[model samples]
Target: MKAVCTVLIACVTMFLVPTAVAQDARRITPEQIDRLVKPYLDAKRINAISIGVIDGDVSLTHHLGTLSRDIPNPPTDQTIYEIGSISKVFTSLLLASEIEAGNLKLTSTVGELLPDVSKANPALNSVQLVQLATHTSGLPRMPANLDLSNVTDPYATYSRESLHTYLSSIDPAAKPGEKSEYSNLAVGLLGDVLAMRSGDDYDVLIRRVIAEPLGMTDTGAMLDPSCLSDSQKSRLAPPHDANLDANYNWHFASLAGAGSVFSTTSDMLRFAAASLDPPDNDLGKAMRLSQQKHAAPIGSGVAMGLGWHFARDKQTLWHNGQTGGYHTMLMVNPKLNAAVVVLCNTAMGDVDALAGQFIQTIAGMNVEPKSFDEALTVPAETVARLAGQYEIAPGAVLTVRADQSQLFAQLTGQPEVQIFAISETKWKYRVVEATIEFELPDSGPASSLTLFQSGMKVPGKRK
Candidate 1:
């Protein structure tokens, strides 16, 4: 009934990138940008797009389409959006600030800050602050005890006690600093520990130190109706799905560090400005430190720097975030002193590619990032043969079905999405880079399938 980001994959900061190389510096006209972006909106692939670009002394803002299918007004700087994993960048900035204050060290262990958690699970004591900031702490993407009862607003009722309980329940999947795994739990924990030590809640700490000083007033952990003025409340860009259908916004309770931010394009541009040019202040130094390469390569052609994700061979940095109903991307080319911020009211994976193009174009790099949308048409009979329910985990099922000539896939607690058969058994999603490959038994229904997403191979067996 709803086109959601899927229960298990919601709020995961994943990107499908097409590489960019610097050949020459070129600038496209505003008309060109409209031509590049309006097609997606016109095709109904998304509801709205808000992009901000800053280069040296030049700045521009572009808005396309309505805020939602029912809302005919275009978005403005006042329009607020949930920034998803981009929130991690702010959390990590606070981490760097703490280090600058001589309050915490990169080598500081979880046992030192979160003693109670480590006391409960001794193995976690060795996880260092660097590992947490760099996604090398070996923590899972999410807490296993996370409540999904309200999939739309999944994190609303998650208590701090729940987070502690989950932390104390299991040993890390890998040794601290041994491997890199994008963990919402680890970063969220880092924020919590920093807050505990700083004598401020995460939201208040960020506002008082980070956002307030930089004049980014419209940003914080979450948007509470009671805290906003009438004009501000009316400016909210209500969340929506890929179909331009209404969708519920995410709510973060205990793990707000993971992705609870609600900010506007202008506000994000303000943050990006600070990132491009660090001031002679603690927060600025923290920003500069957070942008340096502090760890090995992460994701595709990127490395982790505190919370920021940077290119391996270029002076470029970026991070993308997605929740159930929104997708956002922020990119900065410090060497070129240029940055771009992309905010969307719809939940789809295309924002990464769009943002990449914007920065590459502005930086004068050849601006085409290869997309993973190359799809193939398969026989209707093959689609029908693969139609069945596959159990992805203990209780999670992935249901595949064939309607007419189209094939669709639906996770147990998520909405059904159309899939394109690239081959007899392999299918890909247009809105996301995920794929599914079914194994036929040669006689009847498919026996199993493998899901390929963000470099993780998840298998499912017929139920």
Candidate 2:
């Protein structure tokens, strides 16, 4: 189930809204925001959702649902929520700022910053600062030695010592700048290295460089109780899981640079606004540099900037993040000078879809309701016959089981979700837009299945 909760950082551009329509598009009314978000929140059982829209000089925010089912507290623009990997953009901004100050260079190697790391893995000697920011450092998504003691707060105990130990033994899967692989380890190490060069801890450095300059008072790696007033603290939304149950907040002593920031919608929108039109200052220069495409385009028409990923086709820059109990999305269309922020208290909420719809609405694009095929009634015996384990990859298995009259698919390390049968062979998840097609042989039960989602299909063989 933990693997199921892993954030899928997919940035896709749907259809581009016309420039004329975008220019004429007015601010999104609270009523319209509710109409776009309420149905999904109700269907997913998400406790709270807050959205902020920035159209030119106007800012509009809408909040829906309570902070939690038990405590009927509505989240305001000031209510803090854990905004996971969105912190990466902040880290990249720090890198860009350092570069602007001539304190660091994009060509600076990891070996140059931390000799011990290079001594342990010479491959890291070739990993450049820009590679780390653009996710081209050849680092894995997570360290191979990451053995979590507590599932809820997985990164809480992973200290700087743990990071150094992992780096001392790990090897890169590819050459530096050879390919783009999303790596928390890479970015976290970048943050750590930047801190080393600046004589500050990751949190302190972020505040002094990005947060303070931008007037983002409520955004930080550590949200100090003293900094928040009693009312703002009361408005803080409790984290919730897919089932809307209370979930623990994540702590990342070493990996905080990767995804460990709590922020309010207003604070994040302010940051987003700064990104759209950076002021004439050192930090502003860094902001502009961060939006520059420093590397080749990653898959899905997404190009890597310093910290931001650009959707070239749609002419938008965006990033999204998910923690154990929360999901947040920030999208900015610099061309239209429009941005949308969606913050959800529940990890299961589809904030990405919500943000996409919000952007489309503000851009004056038609958004059609998504439709799914009717489920076909299959015999119990037939359903039972299809129940088996399929190998998605080495050490990864997709288990299909018949739960009474319903069929469910559970991938290894992922939560089990019921699949609706489109026919006898095709099935889809109700909550997410994904389909599974079983490959039935001529004379036996299905031996394999293909997963289709986001324009990619992956085949899995029955074990």
Candidate 3:
């Protein structure tokens, strides 16, 4: 039910490599996702998840649950939800579109696209456009100078000049396409350069090139959805977090291309339709090119095209997104002209696993409905005993709290999150892919606790 959670990594929402098992799946309906997702909505774990399924010539959509816990109204196809990094797919398509129009090429270096930045930072000169698209660019996940104080609205203050300053400050990370890293900054810079070259706003470019031609009027670069027309603002579903707390809607100042598209399932299904069978237009040609594998990204076993991640089966191209408040997943199979997209208004641990399970069920595979949370029942006394504060580092404490029915953990300077019990002393986080194990002694409160995440273990002593 939950996978890993990342900060500012709405994988291009959490762009971990997709491991969805591909099989001879039978025809799946839009209702399949609906049935599978009711529990989360019923429990108020998620506000709503708008779903769209495309199987061959048939396509359908469903908006499950209500718009929010307080709002009893269900979301409509026109309900706006942030697609997160799925905007990267559209950004890559912009690159493809530019290439198709003879305005750019994969081999075009960053230096060529933005000579001023490249001149200041020669290392960036060798970074080819394709590397940026495939995330082979040597850029770190984000700029080192990024203001951490505003994690929820990270890109709000990042400007073109900010990117320029960072580019000038650093040396090249590697030969273009020499490394495998999932970088929001790399793709953000790519969009900046593309916009600089085209002399248009990133949003305007996407609307001109992708949305207008495809008739996806409901989709566009994410802005303050509330600032738009009154009608659209009302249509925008409010965002929530895993705690069901009110969450912020992310805005982009310079990284809209990285993760800044507000769209609906119906519009996304249209995008999927185009991906399954590209039209004869120039944009269509670019779409065709984007779906092909262009690089073997370095860090993981994931294969990548322009902005798409190739699943292990190498047949399904998919991407998932998680911002502070919203989570999104998009899967497309061009060969079968089939696809499924799930977009939610609240943050969950892993919408990818949820969607992946739905994919398995559609294969006519028997996958019993199971909860992706702490399932082992522990006595209330054990739960109460575990509640305490542990010191991980100077000024960094892990606080564990428990109500009679549920357990929660909060790190220093971070929001409190619910933790589910998997064993007598082990608990896992549903927000991100991490876990904590209590270092219990023979008796008394647990001696210590260890945080496990991303292959690292940090020990925390009783504070």
Candidate 4:
């Protein structure tokens, strides 16, 4: 079975590297970076990792690990990785650009842009463009009608017709603009509407609206091999699952706006620089507008601004994304005039925490890493008793299983990882700073499991 671990364990342990010499925060040496990253790579057994940082006048990019275990080629700054939901930021940029040009407005309804959609469901008339961008349109996280035959590439078969059908039949759990929820469907719809207004497909719209303006030549929804030099193509990092097995790249016919862009660390750094200090161009103006606070999707601490999420305390604007085989993070602190981009080819590494630590380090802040205790002895029978599937959400499930003396967990569409027992009923994931506690009723088998992570308690009932 594939070992899935948390991003925290992989990212924090690296920052906790002990050093006798006091290192200069302003000028971090490449050797220091390698020392911090190499151990995490070794522990997780990850393939390739590329990190880029922009701190004031100091800009640095480093590539570590091999492209794949089979091929010992090291990745470079030009290595392309699928930057899933980070595409939302680009789609919102398009919205801002159109709004600036008087072509569209945030108040513009989905029905207004796509007349055929209104004909099918008049309810769509109430769903505004801003709602889609902010994830306040009351849309579900995904279409319930999605085909699960190919779990690895879930969105490959989802077409324009499928989106319309799902939208027409959806009974939103909350009213439009009533609550803040993350929705890939909502943002995908926003991209489609923007494309319709621009008289271009999602890919072309992004190139013209955001990529071309910023000179991010290599960043786009559909990257053509003919357009790239042989050297650049050779640097492209192949996607890998949690098990370190080769995974196929994702394709989206209609939902391409949500998470279909392939880009390099260099291109992303350019994009980050533009976001930090927007130029006088139209795209720059739109980029600034996209960063303005719109709504507090999850009630005021970290608010949503177009596609970006604001960390008020950190004075940072950032977004993270994950594809089937890759995990990525891009963060910028305009206050400090610094930004960090972390890209990993393997799905298992914790690029999120890695980027956070890099940003914090650039800001000259002290970071304290979390430590884990040794697992307590638990009998094989006790672990087996807790092994079962638990329903976390309507369609999301977490499956727990025992492999001889060890226990593991597998989330829907995620890889399985060995979980260490903290007690008979409580366990911890070594990769992340999270805990799972199994509830046993006065009688038979385990009834439920509660997952504690990121200040949320998610309870899943055994099926």
| Candidate with best TM-score | 2
The segments of candidate 1 whose C-alpha lies over 4 angstroms from its true place after superposition are 1-26, 298-302, 366-426, 440-443, 448-463
User: Could you tell me the TM-score of candidate 2?
Assistant: 0.86
Which candidate model has the greater lDDT, 1 or 4?
1
> Residue 264, candidate 2: how far off, in angstroms?
0.2
Instruction: Please give the lDDT score for candidate 1.
Output: 0.75
Instruction: List the lowest-lDDT window of 10 residues for candidate 2.
Output: 1-10
CA lDDT, every prediction?
0.75, 0.75, 0.75, 0.73
Per-model TM-score, in order, reads 0.86, 0.86, 0.83, 0.85
lDDT, candidate 3, 1-463, per-residue tens? 0101243122322222223435445567656666678667665678877888876666778777777658988888888887777787888999999898898888999888778877887887788889888878878666766664675676667788888888887865566667776777788888888887788888788888999899988777765544346776778889888777888887786777788878888888889898988999898999999998999746643688998988765778887776778888888866546688888888775566677666555545665544655367778878887889999866568899988757888765444677878897998776665788998766778888998764557799987
Candidate 4 residue lDDT tens string, 71-184: 898788888887777888888888999888888888999888767767778888888898898878888666677664565666667788888887776778878888776677
The superposed Cα distance between candidate 4 and the true structure at residue 152, in angstroms, equals 2.4
Compared with the true structure, what per-residue lDDT tens digits does model 2 show for residues 92-152? 9999998999988999998898898779878778889999988888887777566543657
Model 4 residue 449 CA deviation in Å: 0.5
Could you report the Cα RMSD, in angstroms, for every candidate shown?
4.3, 3.7, 5.0, 5.2
lDDT winner between 2 and 4, please give it: 2
Candidate 2 segments whose C-alpha is farther than 4 A from its true place = 1-5, 8-15, 19-22, 222-233, 298-301, 312-314, 369-389, 393-435, 439-446
